[model samples]
Target: MYLSTRIDKALFPTAALFFVYFLVMVWVNNSYAYFLHEYMGAAQKNVDFEFVSYLAILAAYCSFLCSSKIRTPGDLVVVLLILVLVPHALVLNGANSFAPEASPFSGVPLAVLLGVSLVGLSNKIHFYERDSGEDGRRYIVLLASINIAVLIFIVLKSLGHFSLDFSGQYIRRALARDVFAAGSPSGYIASIGTQAFFPVLFAWGVYKKSSFYFFLGLLNVLVLWGAFGQKYPFFVLVLIYLLMMYFRRHGQIKTAWLLFFAIGFLLLGVVEHEITDYSYINDYFVRRAFVVPSSLLGVADLFASNNVNNGYSDTLIGVLLGSERSDPLSFQMGVSIFNNPDLNANVNFLAISYLQLKYLGVLFEASFVGGVVVLLNYLYACRGSFLAIPVALLFATKILEQSLPTVMLGSGVSFMLLFLVLIAAPPQRRATGSPQQ
Candidate 1:
């Protein structure tokens, strides 16, 4: 059947059910995990709630995807409702059912789920084709130049042309070892280049309307993520900004203003550091700064723990990869990475990684591999929005995660962009005549 007929009968029920489930999960979660230990428990319990929400939202969106010629507004409504409720619900509930930490209860998965939802919703927007414009040759050349420079820097480091040291004293010696052991260069300029490249490329993608630029940005971000580890959110912000610019271009200034206000209020604590003890925002920013250095230091300190010829290096990686939740291992890893001869420092990168991956198995490949797949799937599926900012965002996450443990966080910027895209997407069969709006 047609778009109107199909959505009338099939989509609304699914949307209502999805909303009901989300509300219950957010409002009436009577379990201790949802109430008593909300903020105090490890971050994983909060993540578990998000994983459930994604599954539900994903199913709801899939039904929309199946509808024949789904109307643009219908798609917009479904996606917006999910994006608003799921992540914000988690944020509002916080650690103590309604704990008061900055950016509370919610994290990256929520941001990513919402980002993906926005792109999916945007696919239904009718993009009016432009009269054949100049081919995107100049854009491709510029991006290639940028990628080559970064690649060259990576090669030089691998060959030891310069000592790659970005870990300043903010971290302990042992923790530094873990950072070094991961062994990718943390060079000051290189680090910035890796992080900055995605946004630059994303803006190009939008201006040129080039799919090649889009995928290139996506692939580069993933590779950077794999090389870096855990600090992918910075690059995601770049993508979100690109989308914001797009919305503004499409005459969605009012929508953008509302999003800025909401995110500002939601992440106010994080922005201001109001809640220090067990704060998710603090934990994310502080721990990330230390993780790279601590990991490098942990690698070096492996020798201190035991004699040579006994597989010290392998032991360090094993320690890094194994016994994740073991409290003792956590302490030891920290001391090694931070070079805490006095044993006061707490470098538990691997312990955190392991604890999160314990039930999944030692490989912990889901965060690495499956996360990439989820991001790439979103990018390719919405190819129509090749120049779209949210798509660039989808690419950046996968790209950053490739080298870094760029687990999606409820990024302030991404959430803002989701709101913008949801609002910018045109009503059914409608089209803005010019890029100038």
Candidate 2:
């Protein structure tokens, strides 16, 4: 009886979250299928909505089981999976009609289920004892200072002639793209500063109630935005602030609230579009942000199903094996689907995995990603620092769009993990034996 009661307690919040999430998915799926399809030329197939609804429900159930508890990083990943991956999975089912050879049903659902289960199981495994110690604030400051120095150097070298011009954002973005073209070292440094270092500084500021550091971090974000003409830094800043504020008040991050706010924002966009016929919100948020990316998965599946798998040739493993180089799978997919060689249709990790090794690739990628989530959970548990929450959230967003290897190595999430560890490390003893500040 006691065990059953505990199970019920664990499941109650999960059930409520699942209900709201399901409704949101249904609404969004319908919008994608009909409203956006007709209005914005969004991709869709003639697949039956009833069949897609059933698949979504099954995926949602798997998500619910994975999200039975939400106190850990793994649980948070499941929430993201529910929001991003499940929707993509539904789109894939419809896309299968467009690419029957891909047979998305053969592996997508099983991959998601396995991924969620592994993450949940790994989250429950405790690898380290909690250290009841002061946070490594000094180290964070040191890291932030180093990041600032690096940013200054990069700006002086690469962006010396550029000035902030929000009014001409597209022009500025084109210039920024030229400045930070692929394989540029300064580009990588700038990415690390904005995506990893500054966010951590800002989160630390919020955790310590330091308004000066908070503003400092925010100013750096604006500077990076102006310099790079990238909007994601601002988005990351807002997301981190919201997460920090929520965690401060509630003592835990609630997935339901995240979903609720997201749905509410989308609903407001829908209303705005209906009232004013202004399609900015619908175009950017609904179509560009979610629908376009989700639709690309179908395109990727089609390309991968009909062609030879890349066999990991686009990654470092290929370099180690001396495999012949080829255009990245994203660029290849873009060329195949849209006949645009310059276009890159980067999809989520699952689609990327399938492109690399077919169904078996999905299983390996799922397990690997699950392991990464476990490591993040372990780091958060050991540190007990609220700052880690925002960092983890940033990393989670990366998973939604990029493959695990790219997110970790190329996008500086590995550096974020390193920062978490450094911030949790023990401080050195003073030579003078004075009381430590």
Candidate 3:
């Protein structure tokens, strides 16, 4: 006798359905009026609604496959991007529109539809959940030691430059320099603290409902995001915990929901401190959030203006030192010429990859993204636990704005990530709200 898994049987039909949906969205799509609106007496659209709606449906489907658990900082990123961020971007992008009308065919609908299909390929997958135990003492020690040392350094640095001001001075000062060096305070936080420590600890705190880990996670946020004037570190973590308590209440105490309000109240304080001017929302949501979509302009411009540089030299720099890490003369010239700073914000992974390797770069970038979905799905297939979802989200987060090369090569990211993922507790027998012992 032969047996087949649910995924095996459903794969073809799902793929066919995805293809048909793509066609329908593309064929029956809206005209210029659909994606854009009149603003300031001009027709301008920032986001494509058809795209956002399509992605939401797909994300909902993907969430259903993952058992609909949203319990990690990483999960928040994916969910918020699909639910809150993208939609917000769509609405706000139109706020500044000066165009007369929308385009005949919008890539927003097609791109998101395609993205949904690609994301769905990871459905029905699973991973092994390695349990936390006494055997991991050395690993705990390793993390603790690093955390302590960095904490001390960050404190000293803060004291050396302490002030009661929140006039964007601190943030402006900090962001002015390269913060990715091992010796620099931010390099440790952004690269290591944010990547390795915060996610792992925050996940543990929410999973176990332990104050020790919870506060510890906040400390990580303090040095990396909070002190730097970035609120996302704190925001993403608290959001994940609240969401978990609401969605999966097994280990959670009845009073845990209080933490949600507490975090929110505190977050509002931080937001007030960070706002510099009247354009805060425009700066944060319109300019910052929509970078990924607006980034398509950079890619298009690069391809339109320049002959392919063949990318041989830049690719080497990208892999070894991350993007423009060494900043060789040739690399500097190339960035200025091809990946022009003319764009208001950071470019997306697609633009970075194309700048480095042209069409071949896009292929590599797609494959890596696809691989992430596959690996995460495979883990889910094996374990079917909550842990699998966040870990996958964490890995995917690295690719959202940065190129794969930057993510892979920067900091001690690869080694530290291995430690974080390997040390996670194994999945419980069933995927449910009950706390893990």
TM-score ranking from best candidate downward = 2, 3, 1
Candidate 1 lDDT tens digits, 1-437: 11122253545555545444443433322321132222322121243665566546654654454332212222322333333433332322232311223242123223333333443444433333323233334444754576658756654543422222335223323343444342245443344344445554555665556566566666555444334432354436553555445554662322223334434433442444445434453344322322222222223233223322211122234456563332233344345444455443222222123233232321343234333333332322222223233333443343222211322222122332342334332223322353211
Q: Which prediction has more favorable TM-score, 1 or 2?
A: 2
lDDT of 3 at 45: 41
Per-residue error (Å), model 2, residue 204 = 1.6
Tally clashing residue pairs in candidate 3: 22
Local accuracy of candidate 3 as per-residue lDDT tens digits, 184-250: 5566464664455565556656666767767877777666543355555555576556655564555
Candidate 1 least-lDDT 10 residues = 403-412
The prediction achieving the highest TM-score against the true structure is 2
Alpha carbon deviation, residue 86, candidate 2 (Å): 1.5
How does each model score on TM-score?
0.32, 0.84, 0.59
Off by over 4 Å in 3: 1-43, 46-116, 124-141, 157-159, 162-164, 169-190, 225-227, 250-283, 291-344, 377-389, 411-413, 424-437
> What TM value does model 3 have?
0.59
